[model samples]
Target: MTVVTQEAGAPFGAAPPSGDAAIRTRGLTKRFRGGQVAVDTLDLSVPRGSVFGFLGPNGSGKTTTIRMLLGLVTPTAGDYSVLGLPQARALPKVGAVVEGPAFYPYLSGSANLARFDAADPTAPRGTAARRVADALDRVGLSAAAGKRYRNYSLGMRQRLAIAAALLGPRELLVLDEPTNGLDPQGTREVRALVKEIAAEGTTVFVSSHLLAEVEQMCTHAAIMRTGRLVAQGTIASLSAGLAARIRVETPDAAGAARVLAGLGLPDVRAGEREVTAELGGHAPEEVNAALVGEGVAVRGLAVVRPSLEDVFVGLTGEGFDVDG
Candidate 1:
């Protein structure tokens, strides 16, 4: 890890924005004592105000990267700049919920938030209550502010951790598997909260294993495999090059396959009632017309677009662990 110098580091009170990338890393790497390469030489660029999904299967170094971004763990090599300046200097502008934030179980939500907010000495001396109240409200926990932390459900606890991150103005919010262990309803709630946070113009960086959720919620994404960055781009851009497939079901499936094969279609497969082939930029209209011209009546037809999960599997060769 490159040593952070006095000139490059600043306190939480550093001046307003200085860069375009909310987070940028060059050759960021980490390795434990046992020689486990959790993260390899990575170059990541998170655009400002984007709901960026950091995706990977479990143990793909998502958490380690977040830890390094939040300064919870130091990298064994490389360097990164957050919010346009050296990370140490730009932390106040960044908020994060890394792993499960440990809250005092005996304390009420409001009380716990007050304590956490108080630790940020840069914050004003007199507005603790208001800040805590606003933070809890932001995460939709206003009604449960007075409830003891121990009594909260897993979802509620997760939101509280996010509330804690919102104690003050934040330009960037990094969440690592924000919905890791929640039920479907809880997952929906957290995902909704994430959208709201992004709507407020904050750059939300979410590291999750839920491909569908990421596909639905994130504006941009970066996919990881093993310990390296595999793919990164706007969801549309990343998927734009993925070929679609055409599937048609008909009584004359075998004939249809023969026709498609004669027409130079590749990977044509004929089953009981369906003939499918890799579209490879071939138009569905072209396939449909050809089938009809060949006297094959199309019963059902579809052009299947590849999903994020498809992209993930293709890129990483692993099934996304939604629970991860």
Candidate 2:
């Protein structure tokens, strides 16, 4: 699918989204009280039907950027567009929540969605109802359609929020910390649902501190540090910047180093009982076979690639709770 991703100098919600580019932002900036720069000049693009993960550490401006994109907080500088609408006037088309999604405690899930339909006359009721039903089913919340919001668990409420976001037949769905309170099973379910939605040509722009989750679910990603975009690209391309790590659990570190030197792998470093270095096109199986052939008992061998969390840490010079 053609993706209409973020472009330079494009106003928020202006110009038709071409080639499946669902969301785009350029020079986006946001500042809060006390001179805290919540978001600095940042550029981003999300392709239609793409599961795009926005990754960063806490206070890295992930939430601030989402807020600006949804128009809840205006950017101090730069331009943005969502679903082909200019940010200046795209309020009617965008559906998002920067923080947690709020709902009436007394209202049932279906009733809340119906209320949304009533509020947005532009959303066709028949279409909205169908979308709501589909979303509920997708999120595994169909059984709780009649239950009040207050009775729903945290995960269920989050799913309801996702349903509400899907209610207007939106082509682009933006979520912040979507898996915040979900259990592992609920997280997997939501991740699968996100992929399914993206498969149907709807863009999914989601943010989270957990890089592992993003690595598993997202096709493309952007990394932010202290309100600035430090890295962005496909996973493979990003990994190319970091050195490949090889882990060998051997009783003889010196002997392994000598053997690796014979193999001519560059920048080999030895530590207590383990050695790491860039693998110059040699597969793990090949390395293990070579070691075993040399009478070196290879207890275990594993290749460690730079994870999305690793990328975030490399770019930010810091680390936080990355394994959500």
Candidate 3:
């Protein structure tokens, strides 16, 4: 694995700065009345064309930071840019579903999307109907385009909200908790739609509290804790710093442990039928050969890698609401 040099004073696991970031921030912050700091000074970089997951538990300032980025909320301090342009200039090319999806219950899905497209001064009136149709199709809602918003399923409703965001050509799409409050099927539908959108070369910024959602949908992720970014990088790179372990299942556990310890593997622990050790800079083949040479019967051997959950807990000192 390639080593990434940390920027001076950056939080643990932060990726080095990139020149082609779709979104970048320097000292971004937000403080509400009563001196409650919703978001602390944050430096973020999201690479262009990457599906970036902005993740944290509830009340960890994820939403506040997003609001500041979208200009819906003013930051107490710091600066940010979207698509290499200032917020105001970037807004026209950006589509976002913030907080949650809201629509008139009486309006059909297509009707709601048409209304939204008409409200955009940058959208061409001549392409209104085509845009609406295309947006509905993009979100897999064309079959139910005429369904009343009140009658749409939770998943369909979420798709309609995404359709609204796609009413015009967008360079970037921001979705905040797009799968929140949905059933398993709904969550899957939204996840698939997000992947499809990203496949078409749009940069997607997803703010989610669910670990599974980010793990499955995002190409890159940034973890937040207590209003501060704790880690940021490609999913693979984020976990690369952690050590993997090797497990040997055998009756001669003590013999296996001794061989692993002799090979300089750390944390060698022997159980009745198993021996495990951290496999830092050591090859599993060499360890296996050494064990066999020592006459230890190896029933099973496996390399256990650090998961995203492990990375999260290591960085935050807390577990996440993994499935939510």
Compared with the true structure, all predictions reach lDDT values of 0.81, 0.75, 0.82
Positional deviation of residue 116's Cα in model 1 after best superposition, in angstroms: 1.4
| Model 2 per-residue lDDT tens digits across residues 166-239 | 77656777889888888999888878877887787777788988788888888878877778776676666666
Each candidate's clash count: 0, 19, 0
Clashing residue pairs in candidate 3, if any?
none
Which lDDT tens digits does candidate 3 get at residues 250-280? 9998889989999999888899999998998
Best by lDDT: 3
| 1 versus 2: better lDDT goes to | 1
lDDT of 3 at 232: 86
Off by over 4 Å in 2: 1-20, 88-94, 126-131, 282-297, 317-324
Q: Name the 10 consecutive residues with the lowest summed lDDT in model 2.
A: 1-10
TM-score quality measure for candidate 2: 0.83
Whole-structure CA lDDT of model 3 = 0.82
Q: After superposition, how far is residue 235 of candidate 2 from its true place, in Å?
A: 1.8
